[model samples]
Target: MDHLYAMSLDLNALLRDWPFEPGMLKVRKVTGVDGREKLQMRIDLGVLQMELTGRPDGMRPHGCESLLSYHQNRAALAKAAGNEYELSAEECSELQQEGIQYYHRYVSLFQLNDYAGVIRDTQRNLDLFSFVDEHSQREEFVWNFQQFRPYVLMMNTRAKASLLLNDGKFAEAMREIESGRDAIVEFFQKSNFPELVSKSSEIAFLDEWLEEVSEKRPRSKLEIMQREMESAIAKELYERAAELRDAIKMLKASK
Candidate 1:
């Protein structure tokens, strides 16, 4: 009798030697075999294709909707059934795992200069926090996700500021930075993690960025004018806002 020996392959190890550099990431748009459009992040040793909507892989853990949707709907049903809505720790952990997958994709997207994709993914994670906070109300779980809030906000604001800066919207970029800083402070305050609000390196980075941006601009008339217009609008002074808007248009035309 003749016996054949089989060789086993360690694919993960083999992938480490992929042609791409370890830190390099690429986002490619491709049509899947099923004729669906997919956005895929190609990293050093692997690829992650995310769904444009719904869950990343369209995974609904526990045969329920996304943790967010599930809890919202279940909360409604529970109210109707005279029951209370609660998410078990297992479900919370599962949702956290799902968020981790998106986190990987967003980080890769950021490295690849896909800032818009980063914003999109980061917003979805924020929505996850909202859902968990609304339904769970478990201090530990809520705090766990809250602790992650600032980092996501930081990345989101980075993407926003980058886009605005690319568009020559200096004032808008500054506003984004300020908004992100305020959001981080608010999150920490609400969660009773007040000490961390002032201590976070992310907040410090935003402050540094804001200062750098402030010094970089010599107050281009259009930028200054536009900021005034935005302030007017925020204050419900539409007439003044319109006047400033027209003035800005005229200024741009003069230039």
Candidate 2:
């Protein structure tokens, strides 16, 4: 197996060329064995597969829960042993690096319209930040994690809002946006970093989204009927689906 692996590397080098572009990025949705939809990005080198939730590769670290879960479990064990929850800089760094990988996957998931996946990954990172802040007690480490909390909250809020909007819950989505902005502001203000809060691009984004939602025209009857038709079909309510389909056509024709 070792010899075969070495030969494969040689073959890869032999086939390699200059001006490589990593080919084109081709994306597709796939359903995993667990019956969840996922996304795969294909390139010349290889294909990258990601889950819609939990870890990007769908692998459980430590053969159980995530790093966040592992830390929490250990913290409990430490308490039982009458020891304090302690983590080195290296452990924190490792967890942070793991988070970066999930961040990449979540970005791709967002682009693929997988808002739930984005929410899952963002929440995981947020949990990590909370865990470090509570346990580490290192001022520098806490400060560094603090810098990312607002951004994580913003991303989580965006994902939640997007999901809500997809379900035609516009009011709830708008509220989520507003609340997210307020949360960021509050976090910074509490930390005595009001300047950082003011400079956040996410605050501007939330404001713009708020304005857009508030000022946007109401959905046309035809549009609403069409969405209802889709919802009925998804629910397998054929009779209701037919009614909504006809209603959509009637509304469209009247327009």
Candidate 3:
């Protein structure tokens, strides 16, 4: 199993200077060996879909030597979510539930061989990254207690731009759409887990959703920030309102 890690290292070493954009592969993940050893696997191309003989080790294979290697003659595994990192149990449950819905909505996307649909739906799932442990939201890490964001936004923006380009926004949304492209690439690069390449967007939609959730009903901590923003707005604090808006995700469904 450990040899898998060496193989992956070799692959990376080979491709490190390929000059191809890193996230171009779209898939990122570590796989355990033959279901018996959880020490290694390969990455690239797409998400982990192998039915290994064993369950996930419940921990990411770490270290250059401890990680597994890529399967022989097999393509590098891609990540289903923009992220390919681990998480806390509670957070994992929430993400899994959301992931199912994402997969279902576009279930036919893949069935019909709609690669675009696959991209859109997959990106949306990653963008809506959620953390049940609310406090963890303050920290922006891939394994931040089941949280999934940043990268998702990048994928979502690209998906949106692709769809929008096909729609009627070609002329009007050019600036934002282009900005999204750069953002998607930028943010993805900064992401961990599946190791999203840098990507960007016009608006951090998920961040807004969280803000709306905090404001619509006001959780204990949210209530205070909500008040501050309201008061600031009343005092002509346009900047403050904008800041607050950017700071939170507007959880309309939470209502």
Candidate 4:
């Protein structure tokens, strides 16, 4: 009789090598046995392996790339037939679950400093939220998913601004942050949750980050003179203000 051996499914060696940290997102990219790149996140329990593209788990639902894509095609077909299509509560729940998979992938991508991937996934979730909000049969299902809009918006904004920062465009990054802040505020107001704006941690974080970026941004000579002129005028120093104003005019003319 031939001796038989079994392949072990245990992750003991893998988890032992990469111990989980308490407050850090530990992620890595590796080539799979099939020679395809994959993302692996280290968690407290063990490890999570994800596809670098497409669905995180690399599963296709309804023969479509994603649940969102599948539903979008269905909606398009219904529209062409002059029929209205709305997502049922169960379908909405399914979408919510699918969104979670994308969320995990984006968060892991962010940790890997892949800002573009982060933006792509966040934007996808935002589109998913809009679709469900527009077509969900129940308001409660819409609310459940839409409630996370602010957080996703913040992540998207952060990624855009980070890309600008990477290119050493501090002023542009600041503007991007401002735009993101406005978007969050608008979302709250439109959702009839204006009261939450003041208490929004996302908005507060962006505001603080914007201030820091502004303080560090390099200023042109003309901009500096303009700021000085404004300060002098506010302090009732007409002579200083007039001098700065004339200097600023000369600088602008030279430019």
Measured against the true structure, the TM-scores of the candidates, in listed sequence, are 0.69, 0.69, 0.28, 0.89
What overall lDDT, based on C-alpha atoms, would model 2 receive against the true structure?
0.78
Q: What clash pairs does model 2 have?
A: none
Candidate 3, 177: how far from true, in Å? Answer: 3.4
Assess the local accuracy of residue 140 in candidate 4 as a C-alpha lDDT between 0 and 100.
Answer: 84
Clashing pairs in 4: none
In the range 11-35, model 4's lDDT, one tens digit per residue, is: 7888999999999889999999999
**lDDT by residue for model 3 over 1-255, one digit each (tens)?**
899877865654534533344433222223445443222212353223322121132322232211222111011232433433334456445445545545443433333344476575665455434322322333443354233444445444445544554564553335444565455555445545334331222245534433443344324556666777888899999998878765544633354
lDDT values, one for every candidate: 0.81, 0.78, 0.43, 0.92
* lDDT agreement of model 3 with the native: 0.43
The runs of at least 3 residues in candidate 1 whose Cα sits more than 4 Å from the true structure, single-residue gaps closed, are 1-30, 37-45, 60-65, 80-83, 221-255
- The digit string of per-residue lDDT tens for model 2 on 26-132 reads 56677877788877665466556777566676778787556778878999999999999987898788777777767777767777787887888888888888888
TM-score of 4: 0.89
lDDT of 1: 0.81
- Ordered by lDDT, highest first, the candidates read 4, 1, 2, 3
Error of 3 at 82 (Å): 33
Clashes of 4: 0
- Two-way lDDT contest, 3 vs 4, winner: 4
